[model samples]
Target: MLNDFSPAAAASSFSPAFSPPEVSQPAPPTFTSPAAAVAAAARLAPRLFEQAARTDEVGGFPTQEFAWLRETGLLTAALAPALGGAGLGEPAAALALLQVLYHVGRGNLAVGRLFEGHVNALLLIQRFGKPAQVAAYAADARAGHLFGVWNTENPAHGVRLNFLAGGTYRLHGAKTFASGAGHITRPLLTGALPAHHGWQMLVLPADEQPPQLDRSFWRPLGMRATASFIASLERLEISADCLLGQPNDYYQQPWFGGGAA
Candidate 1:
């Protein structure tokens, strides 16, 4: 049976200990429906394709196309209206998200992957984050900030979270196969808790301090523009509010397996 871990339940379990830094909000979304968003994506596809060859040849991050995506308001469409988004409500959200991904995927798989991660991060926040957290992240998203989910772990140096004084946490070690490494503004990462079993999920500024990226690690023949790299988060301090849910929440039985499916 799938475990029902609702946002309200998650919020009730933890109290906010800090607030995210303020961010200026962007202009209102230009498109509201999936069809309109997809249409806009279609209009941008050719330009993205034009840069695909170079982006692949460079074998690094895809920067130019993302600017177009942000300008078109495709990145913030999935967010709820209360959070400064286009308000593409349910029964249609899945289809809308699918269409957006499909159109972008047609232009470049690497960019599509990054965009998919961004959407996943936003959904996780929407599902488990408190109201303040949601609003803050929404504003960041609206302002063209990119989000990513980096869960892959390194066997040699497993990611760990150390509890600090005053209810804060510090992240040590690194995560491998982290996509959009340098470019992802806020990334949802997983770390094992010190002296505690299971993992914790956290959202932090990926580039707040320079992350150690092993550029030599990714040499894929395809999806070269993804910039998937090894990021060392040694001694990265995380405020209490950045922690989502509770210990073991990340791998919580049916939710991790079933909900993801």
Candidate 2:
């Protein structure tokens, strides 16, 4: 029930301004300062939870709540302290996200689900992206960019990877159940490569026009607000940098289920 991809509705631009990220932790255990961040979430919990959950039930993204998240330090929880973020690691950040989810769930499941995608997308950028990629995503997020995932393909099968003449590969077929389809500023997408043997991750700038929704139908009973939509790939251009890692890099990570589930 969503509209086709429209470039105009996408974000014009995004950039996050903050100090450089500290290189000390490829992945840290505890937050640089847990108490402070948690305390902050506690204070803003009432408002944040109410807004995100409400919008989820209404079948829309909580734009205002996301803005508040950016204003607050919650959205940048995983970025290093040096980068003007809470610098919380996976575990700590997970805890904070869970708190948000709990509040959202109390209000509505759709909101909690979408929020999880945003958090997971942010976490992936923080964990695997190159320095510049990290900095860019962090900057955009701080500057109010929304992120999500778009991996679920048709119930029949997922996207396929076709071996190309070069070392590169091509993605054929389509993906369904793309949540945050129109609202996200960036989305973590997934597909497979025939040469590789498993799935791969790719970060697409949602600032471009949103993808067109397929008329094909398979509506579920509940979770209507998810806005799960369909999209096709016909010779979409992607470079080596577009690739996240070897096959299955996305699903292999321990934090794969960090916020989504």
* Residue 30 lDDT in candidate 2: 25
Q: Estimated TM-score per prediction?
A: 0.83, 0.71
Mind giving the per-residue lDDT tens digits that candidate 1 earns over 1-261? Answer: 002212122211111112222445446456756678778878887887778877884445677777778778877876876665555434456676677788888888888888888877887788778888988888788777788888887555768888889998877777778888767778888889877667888898754644566655677876767878677777778788888777777676644653354
- Most accurate candidate by TM-score: 1
lDDT of 1 at 215: 56
On lDDT, the candidate that comes out on top is: 1
Model 2, range 11-55, lDDT digits (tens) per residue? 332222221234442322223474565665566667754554355
Worst 10 residues of 2 by lDDT: 12-21
Question: Per-residue lDDT for 133 in model 2?
Answer: 78
Please list all clashing residue pairs in model 2, or write none if there are none: 5-210, 5-211, 5-212, 7-209, 15-139, 16-139, 16-140, 199-248
Q: Candidate 1: misplaced stretches above 4 Å?
A: 1-28, 87-91, 252-261
- The parts of candidate 2 lying over 4 Å away from their true place are 1-32, 48-59, 92-94, 155-157, 161-170, 215-225, 257-260
Judge candidate 2 at residue 158 and give its lDDT: 59
